[model samples]
Target: MGVNTLYFGVDFGTTNSSVAVYDGHRAWALPLDPENDLPTSLPSLLYISRENEKIVGRAAADAFIARNVDREVKTKQVDLGVSVEAYVGAEPEKSEVFNPALVDPEVRHAVRARATIEVNAPGRLFQSLKSLLRQPAFKSTEVFGTPYQLEELVSYILSPIKKAVDGCAGHAVETVVFGRPVRFSDCDDENRIAEDRLRTAAKLAGFKNVAFFLEPVGACVEYAVSVEEKQCLMVVDIGGGTCDVCIMEFQGGSGPEQRLAESRILSVAGTPVAGDALDREIIRNRIFPLLGSKARYGPSNLPMPQYIYNQILDWQNIYKFNNEEMINWLLAAEAFSNCPEGLRALRCLIQKNYGYLVAREVEAAKKRLSEVESTHITVQRDDIQIDDILVREEFSHIIEYTLGEMRECILEAEQNAGIRPSDINLVLTTGGTCLVPAIRAMLEERYGAGKLRSRDSFTSVATGLAVVARYV
Candidate 1:
């Protein structure tokens, strides 16, 4: 590599993103968003304004909350187009209907239908676009009447990171190595499609040369820097959108690039279950009842619709209730519900668009529970008020399904590697979700507690990717 040539590593994770650079001797994460509490990482979120201006990271989240949360929802009529329709009276002859020239000009007047659209939102907020890369059907979406392809949405997130990188390098660097999940989707074809989409996104972000690196393997590279002798290692990366496990044998002597090139990758596996799923489960199991998920409504006293509350699981889905049909349904349900207070709170949540706020509170509570035995969630917004205590045991139970999937993925990786848990010399855990007590206990039980090691949970992949970027 020429002294003038610079390579940067970008870990564009599902929940957060970071950029790093490696000098010949060392790799370190750059301060992408120093104002942020987590200076090295930025939340992977984007907001597109009505004027088509884009904002990302913490600012994007703050813009969404300040502009949307607790704001009154209003509707407007938008003219799609004009249609010409010919009408014939019930007593009109068939010739009049069949022959347009014979029809009266009065009957041929233009008919226009105006579509009712929800308005008043300052902008549209997009999150977790990385998770949708593997989905073939999620091609594009319109924001404020302008259509944006999936890659374009991702590019917005990358653009800011690249700008920061260029600022640090004192030049516009076009070459980068990005970390990707071992498998974006269950199918190999879908994984390839996801990578291609990511590559396109990087190109749109102004990169000329983009390379992909496995997320788990990147974590492994960081861990390998400390190892001097040969060791069989299993690296588990549980981030916001996916969990990836890689089993490899590493002998560290040379630099990160040479060490990785000489290492043996035994097997790898991944599943789309991680911190985000755990957050949703907390919303579903702990917070739903408070929002009247089980309340009864109508003359027959039927139970409230589970589908309505399920929308709270995803912040984007909460906006669906901004329309007339859903608003009417919520109003009618609140009027007739046995738990009127809960339904009213639910109305406030949807009408005021507080789903993101609620999600953030729940996610914070989840993180707190990881460190403490119990945590309290207090969200007081207009008619909506919630005070709940989440115990660690209950939190563990809430995420059992997700944890079980992770366990299954690990077992699959071990089987593919033709090795048992005991055969592994060390279990390296990285990513945010690895901090959960249950996850740590699970690893300790499967592989001896003494054999488990952890690198920096959040920035290891970015640092390792920087190391790889040096060679790529």
Candidate 2:
């Protein structure tokens, strides 16, 4: 069995990425992480942690060791599940516990693969490789003394997924169709730059021939599968980093030519305000105050610099809080605030690189709130303890601005599509945010309850891209 298909469709997203393949008879998603038995869609997350003895992707291990590894090593257990566990003994040991020098090359590469992504927990964790593609200020970042360009970093993230694709297809896949948002971030130039970067990454990831498709349009293909009649539809994709809306016309059927010839791409619009923004909002509103972000400074008794609190909102930038200048600034603010307890809270949170941990808690809470009226935001670190209550109403209010912006984006897509809401036959919504009750209600309110529909929120794009891969 050689490469079974001509092309694969890859939806390389901000929070999670996914890949789908098309055979002559059908289209289906391929699981990118066989090691963890992840679903068809892969978390668009890449983490690098050298200090941690365990190396697993997404939910495996933290994929990193906090800088306290030297100290924590005495407590952190080697993953007994792996053969390497015997190398470190049955119990937790000292700092040099599972040195890579003594391990097999496969284990060493697994531990050291993609260290240049984002989060660095006390210096062990990193993630969110897709977001950096749009940052003009980010040219290169170094990891463990190795300098990496954004493409190389993203490519590294894609490497494993490519391997999975090859193994599943029985032959190496060289041509691919990549699903991308119509807009990346907020600007046209940035979107173009990001697409270019994605192209490079796809190439670097092992696809020799690559193509691009708008994310929602790809989802349109997914939705059209069930319908037999031609229809006009709107697709709203709420992803980790951006919200993209598209209006398209589809001729629903399995014939590749009929599928390709009839689909018309109409309005495409997007905004940077999406799930990550909501995650940040949760961090700011519910988690910050508990971390002494709102406390007054000492002598002057003035409010601490707001950036000190705001900077840690994104786990992407959490490591920035540990720089020397930021430390000095915090120290001065601590002295001026005169509140030793509050200042200490801030210092301890920053010193331990608690942002990622807190953000993770906030995220888990946010998801819980979506399903229930309220949830708990637990922050338990060395000395910083916070078990705060967060209600869905409060979360709704916190993310009101984001909701409003998403509303505006939807309307913009409608306006640009040159059709009234009534003219649209169906409103297809997907992505993690699509599950949000408030978001669902908002769509239902505007599109009429009967006109709105839902696809597999997380895997729709990849599935559709798989179908379109054959044609595009």
Give the top-scoring candidate (TM-score).
Answer: 1
Q: For candidate 2, which ten residues in a row score worst on lDDT?
A: 110-119
* Number of the top lDDT candidate: 1
Query: What is the alpha-carbon lDDT of model 1 when measured against the actual structure?
Result: 0.81
Please list the Cα RMSD from the true structure of every candidate, rounded to 1 decimal place.
9.0, 12.8
Superposed Cα deviation of residue 118, candidate 2 (Å): 19
| lDDT tens digits by residue: candidate 1, 49-68 | 88888888889998888876
Off by over 4 Å in 1: 3-5, 72-118, 254-258
Which sections of candidate 2 miss by over 4 Å? 1-6, 35-38, 50-56, 59-61, 65-124, 252-256, 323-339
| 131-206 per-residue lDDT for model 2 (tens digits) | 7788877878765555668887788667877887888867887877888887787877887888899899889989
Indicate the residue-level lDDT of 308 in model 1: 67
lDDT of 2: 0.70
